[model samples]
Target: MSTDRKPDIALHFAPRTRSFVALWLLEELGVPYTLESFDLRGGRPTTPEFRALNPLGKVPLVVDHGRPISETGAIALYLGDLYGAPEAVPAADDPDRPAYLRWMFFVGNVMEPSFCQKMFGWEVAPSTAGWGSYARMFEVLTSAVDGDGWLLGERFTLADVILGNYVRFGLQFGMLDADPRLERYAARVTARPSFARAMAIEERESARFPPAAA
Candidate 1:
């Protein structure tokens, strides 16, 4: 059932990006892999070799068995399907499957654009915008994680890994300011052992590539 038949699993990654989600996922998978870590600002991903893998030259490019996957949501789903246990990825019969897929896409489709709109002061009607406005996105997210420990209740699946980083970044960048429930939820997700492992790697890579000057 695994896509990558070969043993080679390398993450084409850079720190301080969505690569954090991919890092968290690899740790959760508990699989042996290599990190092709680099600095985005240093033009590592833009090289001809790396650009062949992902034309956009983006980080979080996961190469499994020499096959490349670029998007963060897609990477989460890929690793979850291939290596994740039942707890990480519910079976087809599981009722949480639908919600799991929904929230995963919600992070990229809804949260990404909505956050951009809010940050850049973009003006668009709720009915016209696909995300219905950043305010609505927050409302739906807050409602989902308000009382529940995870998105699918007790089960902490790949959806958490997909959405948790965005929620954490939102708080850190003041995008989701003054939201107590979301703050607590982000804390809980980052407190996981897998997250700790990812953070350790992140720290090492970040030190390797200090951020570019503004």
Candidate 2:
């Protein structure tokens, strides 16, 4: 079931942000969509109109035929299934679908909070927190991706998009410096041509919205 009637997809985006992951996924899909790029410093996300669609006031919000879908994972799953089905998204009965969904959720459910925990020096019991401890999160991720293929093996699905971006950002933020498995995994993820194209766009946009002078 498709959400957008006209396929007039719009990505509310920002340069050098988590929006990059969304942008990357879009490029991988090779779909024609409009980019509503803006500088967050200008408060585009805070406006009432934007908030009406995305109360979280976050970038990487995708609007499909005027219907807004926020959150990277949700957006990724939605767009992938809607547009890239049977390729980026497995069929409902596909064996890979199970693994795909699990890895898709892992980034948000485990990785994100765990990274924040480590970054902010928050101490939470592994059993208490949703993501467990950062160390435990890394251990599990290492076990998952410490291999010669993508998360779903031969076929690269949207799980790669969701989790791969996590790995890339993890390395960028020095969060995954302790492990080489994720490093190798990210190497393959970045090696994709879409990653290159997305980085190119990211460069072009970042230049337009250059960082403010320190």
Candidate 3:
């Protein structure tokens, strides 16, 4: 449901949150937008004004078309289909469309929660749990990467934006082991100019709100 007129896009963002994922996707879309960067450490999100946009008071909320869009996966899909350049979003009839959507959901649904489960040593049966087990999740992700590289074979779509960022974070935090193929895929996709742009923005914002003293 894209509007005919391009609405002003404002990213209500903060560093050290899921906000970076949206920033990377927006840069990859190559669209002109403004960053409403704020410091979560400063207690801005708890204000009534911010809570009006998201009751949960979260960052990385995108206000486009005069409406706020929360959740990283939703924001990526909306922006990808609406303004993504070089056809980063697949056509409705494309065979890879189903798989493309699946990967987008996988990042938030399976990847994040499973990583938390592994990190915390949560006890949950693979058969009953929605994400199964961390091992299975990792295996599934590994199998998704094909010989041609990228999730969708030859095309690099928004799926890469979502999945690539998560893998990059996993590698950085040592949550994931040294899987050569995953490492290569993360390097390849994130090496894009768009990712560089996102990183630059992230660096500037982080400096403004430096990590707390140890």
Candidate 4:
């Protein structure tokens, strides 16, 4: 067995949140790390202890080398770049870098908010909204994949790591209907040994802190 201790990647995870993305990235990197699960029900993340890590009181926060990194895209990109896993993340010099960054941020900034808006019946004007509308966002997402196994052609980069979580969540919550392409892609990605292990961890965490309150 490897005697080296896992890198100090402190993940403050909560059930049914974007923490899954960080967990999946850790698994994909095949690195050992510590997981500090926080319950959102009691406002645990907002407590002084957790607030010191992230004032926003959000899950999916990571403290690497004592540097707190919140936001899923930031954490994924940081890990992928630091670990030199170009296959999991494109290099900055790659021609696809622009596209990769664009989509990665889009998932967090655009798609996620749109999903929440649609799910919660929030009021908004399509003209003023960056996401335009839920249908529009979904259409764009579908077109981006277009039956591809991954977001960037044959390469399964960090883009997949970002979008894969949403695809699964959307399908599970009935926010997204069955698209053969998305179905195939999600299946293919989740079937990876790394993803399987991540899902196991997430499942256990979910059991420990159910998402009913969140």
Candidate 5:
């Protein structure tokens, strides 16, 4: 039994969703925290107890100092700042800030929405759709990963933390095919000890919750 202080940051997780992103971020930060796994399909997150934390009933929510924060992007950015790894996340004044911020937002704003749309059999008109289309989004993503091991070149930054998870999710869900670049990148990110540990936790928790009805 470990006796670390009740972490000021607690993550509400559900396996195989955006929770993995937060899990990876927490692992990367090497922070001491608690993970409260919710079975979303079982309404574990919607119960009166959890509803007080998030009325929307979403997983991947975080409580920091008793204040609730929802959405994966927000949680990732917050963790990056709190952990303060300049290598993992560049400072605002850093010359790489623009590219770094662009890719970070791209995962949430572009990739995720586009992924959901395509996964659900919805089609968006290119003229009005913010992501243009799923095809275009993949093209953009592949192009970004074309050059190097990391998104912003040799240094692995928070943008990698964001996009790396997306790539892994896309591959696991079959939303993405094996692009050599993405395949290589995914392997590199998951090969990290922290990511491997997070994956182990996710797998164990997933077994605890059976799948929803067909």
Candidate 6:
């Protein structure tokens, strides 16, 4: 959504964190913006002003024309709607919207929490837990994400940005059980120029804030 006036957008991001999702999204948006990159240890996110924008005190927050957008799914949807057209996001009434929204929410709602459940070795009844059990979560993933390649087939949407990045990270860090199709999918996601650009900026910021000597 281009305008005669360019939007004053800035991302309050921290390197080597979930902020990469927002960074990649911004790159995909192809809009001019500033990266308010900083290290988390600086106590910036915990500040009152920051918390006012996002009560969670998190990175990956986008200040778009003075309106703050937090949460990965919300960020993806908001930015996608603002800048995405003809591609990136499916139109509201489009047939793909339902599934697009499903997978988009699936990331933060099911996938990430399931990983946490795995990490903590927590056991909860399938019906009790919000993630509906880790194994069950994976089952749903295994079924939806197969041979078709893109979750929505030929269309790559914001859902791919959210879930695809998790799958890519899982593949990279050995966090996910081996699934050949997901492996191929991660390869496809990483191959995107937007992903590459985001990684490059991450590298530069990472070095710029290299860990302090012990």
Question: Runs in model 6 with CA error above 4 Å?
Answer: 1-6, 212-214
* Tens digits of per-residue lDDT for model 5, 22-51: 888888878888998867787787688788
Query: Which run of 10 residues does model 1 get worst, by summed lDDT?
Result: 1-10
TM-score of each: 0.94, 0.95, 0.94, 0.89, 0.89, 0.93
- In the predicted model 4, the residue pairs found to clash are none
lDDT of 1 by residue, 1-214 (tens): 2345344689988888888889988998888899988878778776999899999988889998879989999988877878787787976678888899999999989999988998899999999999999999999999998975899998888899779989999889977755989988999998889999999999999999988769
Give the runs in model 2 whose Cα sits over 4 Å from its true position: 1-6
Clashing pairs in 3: none
Model 3 misplaced stretches (Cα beyond 4 Å): 1-4, 146-148
- Residues 148-211, model 4: lDDT tens digits: 4688887888778778788888888876777877777778777778888888988998898776
Error of 4 at 202 (Å): 1.6
Per-model tally of clashing residue pairs: 0, 0, 0, 0, 0, 0
Which tens-of-lDDT digit does each residue in 134-197 have in candidate 3?
9999899877864557898878889998999999999888776668778888889889999999
What is the Cα-based TM-score of model 1?
0.94
The TM-score between candidate 5 and the true structure equals 0.89
lDDT of 2 at 32: 82
Clash tally for model 5: 0
Q: List the residue pairs that clash in candidate 1.
A: none
Q: Model 6 over residues 1-214: C-alpha lDDT tens digits?
A: 3235556799998888999988998887788889999999999988999999999999889998999999999988877876775566888888888898899999989988888887788878878888897788888887777775688988877788789899988767665787887887788877889999999999999999887789
Residue pairs whose backbone atoms clash in candidate 5: none
- Candidate 2, residues 1-214: lDDT per residue as tens digits? 2234346799988997899999999998888899999998999888999999999999889998789999999998888877885766887787788888888889889999988887889988889998889988888888888888888777888789789999989888877655789889999989999999999999999999999989
RMSD of each: 1.8, 1.7, 1.6, 3.8, 4.0, 1.9
lDDT assessment of candidate 3: 0.85
Query: By summed lDDT, which 10 consecutive residues of candidate 4 come out lowest?
Result: 1-10
Query: Which ten-residue region of model 5 has the weakest summed lDDT?
Result: 1-10
- Which candidate model has the greater TM-score, 1 or 6? 1
